[model samples]
Target: MATIHKLIALALAFTALVVVVSPATYKEGDPIEHKSLTLGEVLDGDRMAHSLYDIKFRTDVPSKKVLCNVKYTEKMLDVLRSAIEDLYYFEFVLDDIPIRGFIGHLEEGGFLPHNHKIYLWAHLHFNIEYNKDHIIYANVTTKDQLPISLDGATTPMELVFTYSVKWMNTDLSYEDRGTRLRDNSFFPKNLEIHWLSIINSLVLVFLLIGFVVIIMTRVLKSDFARYNIEDEEEADDLDSDDNGWKIIRTDVFRFPPNKNLFCAILGVGSQFLALATGILLMAMAGMFNVHRHGAINAAAVVLYAFTSSKLG
Candidate 1:
């Protein structure tokens, strides 16, 4: 009874520990806290753009070039139309570019075709120029405009704007991947320390969980041994008799096992083996620095029927 209690307590404690530790190790929140938008979504379109006026000066370098692109949805057509019609420049303060782009409206195909839902698309360009000391800095801002309107808006608008920027230092060498393709010299430096700190915290949590598990397992084992009673021992000894085995054989094996139990055990075991093997192969490939193209899951079953033949 004591051993059973200890085992139950150990299981409960381990479960509780896992629940607490696992959450801390891996937690994902809004990439941009105030403006719940990812880098990709922010670049997608401006109408959908979250109101993030200040590009919190994370990190940047003059020598190391950085490029940024902004895209706006069709809804932005109204804003642009109002800007162009007003003649007064709707000043958009860009921190990095150190300037603003004056927007305007034009006829269909004046910028690009009025596609499925888009009124038009615009592009903005930034080229780096240097001061007298040859210290490179963004020197020019090129404003490209598209004229358009949106269906969802209560009023008519023109020119939806979307822009992409790319910057490269002639001085630096770097590899190009889908993500993190910036020159390390200019890469957001502050984020490096912050992300590393998060990683270290996760590692510490994992180690603490391991230590807790070890200590709890050892303590429970000792406790169980100390409190184990004598009556259950005698019962177990009696249950080990030869007649017990005979009774089990007659009651269970005599029926050749229930079909449901046989199928369940066989099916579950086979599936588990197959799944474990697949996971092992995938893990091995990943460990060896191999990229997994895809995963394959398979299931198979064979059925057979038998007939007896008799000879006279």
Candidate 2:
């Protein structure tokens, strides 16, 4: 009975610690206003000329009211009309932090032309951070979508915007902040990966290397064994005329015209190869700092310059 009471007390204490460490609390904001939606000026160019539908949706809830907007261009509209897929951009503000993201369909594949009026819904996702004193930092997350066309409709197309907010009890890191800002400004939703094509190329390369290695090994072994045979008959029959490589054996091992230059070039090439391999391995191991692209690029340039100094 004493042990059981102690176990119950321990469990309650652990639960209290967890609640104090990370508490989950959230407040849903009001629905975004429609009048905030505005249109930007349209420019004319071959493919560059375009106009955008600026969606300025605002929400008044939580501690303060925040506004988010996205731009949908004519090119995007045309793509939807042509049954092609695309993602549209939108920017919004939460706690004075500008979050940018895309507005896309939940389903995969391109949108088809519809004879009747269709309703396009906008889904919004907010990534929120919960810190001390119930402070919350929120931002939008977006995904890619295909272009949508609603032509030849009896009535105007209706765009209904829906939103969901997710919260976690953790302080935002520098990387998280940088990523949110960068993604809102210049990032797109879709990342194309051609893994199949890459795999096929790698397979071809390995096959070619294996073939060369096998052929070279067999030829070298045969030539050395034939030339160095203990049997006098076999050695005599394998003459210089029969083995053309044996005739130029001395030249093959001879030094190049500029020995110093050759050595310097070889050393430089070796250093570069080593550096490249080291960097690749480190990247694969996730050793580099994320969101420090400028630092990484500067370090690479300095290292390359230091290594190239060996050429002098």
Candidate 3:
């Protein structure tokens, strides 16, 4: 009986390894909290506004919830009005997923007047995706809202916010989940050929090269004929008629103004060129990460900082 049990355990381990099936017990975590939101005034992180979450725990989850009504004064309404005009988006952070919602969507992202009836997002549906027993992703979608007129309203208006939570089971790993989120990924997956974009790019390149080659060949052919002129008088005539790129020969060959600045620019360009080449070579050789952009950004930062003295 012990030998039979050993055989069963060995069979299970072999099957797991062959099928690459990942199985684990679910560990319940503390209640979800801290649903913060933020607005980025500038692209800079320091120039931003944050509304930290004031979390509350409840037992009767009751998928759909009516947290409370928020009373907004005219001043608050004006702030939101400006946000809508600027087409700002609200971003919230869940455990691992980053949720982004537009403050409000307008046709062609048009601005609305205060006198016009405006609608605010009142309900949100939170969809949580889990694999095996671990929460992997969370997403929110705006569902329903009623239009409220803010024209000539003296009383404080109530902005009711409600939310619902739902869980979904997935059979994907962490990496697969992330790639799936990037639905329109730029990279070629599984060595698949992107024939459409590739053909378009190739045709465009050939057209551009054809124009440049034809034009340059004609210009250089005339230049060559002038240079090889046997008659001195005719040669002077051809040189005098130098109108296109030939006219700038002396200027292009001469030293540029601001020698220091020119040298600095050249050095910086060369440094960056070298840096880019190195990065591409390393990336192709599997030095950096495959999908995570943070890795690329971190590599670029370190490389730029170290090579700044030489490049800049």
User: Largest TM-score belongs to which candidate?
Assistant: 3
lDDT of 1 by residue, 1-312 (tens): 011000000011222221221111111232221224333323332111121121212122323222222233344444434444443222122221222333333333334655333232234444433232232333224443344443364433222233333444543222112122122122236644477888999999999999999998886675454445368865564434333223355566554558778766766666656655655675556431101111222111111011111100
The worst-scoring run of ten residues by lDDT in candidate 1 lies at 1-10
TM-score of each: 0.25, 0.40, 0.54
Q: How well does candidate 1 match the true structure in TM-score terms?
A: 0.25
Candidate 2 residue 9 Cα shift, in angstroms, is 52
Give lDDT per model, in order.
0.33, 0.43, 0.51
Give model 2's TM-score versus the native structure. 0.40
What lDDT is reached at residue 237 by model 3?
Answer: 71
- The better-scoring model by TM-score among 1 and 2 is 2
Which should have the higher lDDT, number 2 or number 3?
A: 3
Task: Name the candidate that leads on lDDT.
Answer: 3
Give a tens-digit lDDT track for model 3, residues 156-268: 76655566666677887875766655553333356665889989999999999999999999988887787778999987776565466666888988998898999998989
**In candidate 2, which residue ranges exceed 4 Å CA deviation?**
1-185, 188-193, 236-244, 301-312
- C-alpha RMSD of each candidate structure in angstroms: 23.1, 17.0, 14.6
| Residue pairs in candidate 1 whose N, alpha carbon or C atoms collide under 3 angstroms | 45-71, 46-71, 46-72, 146-159, 147-159, 148-158, 148-159
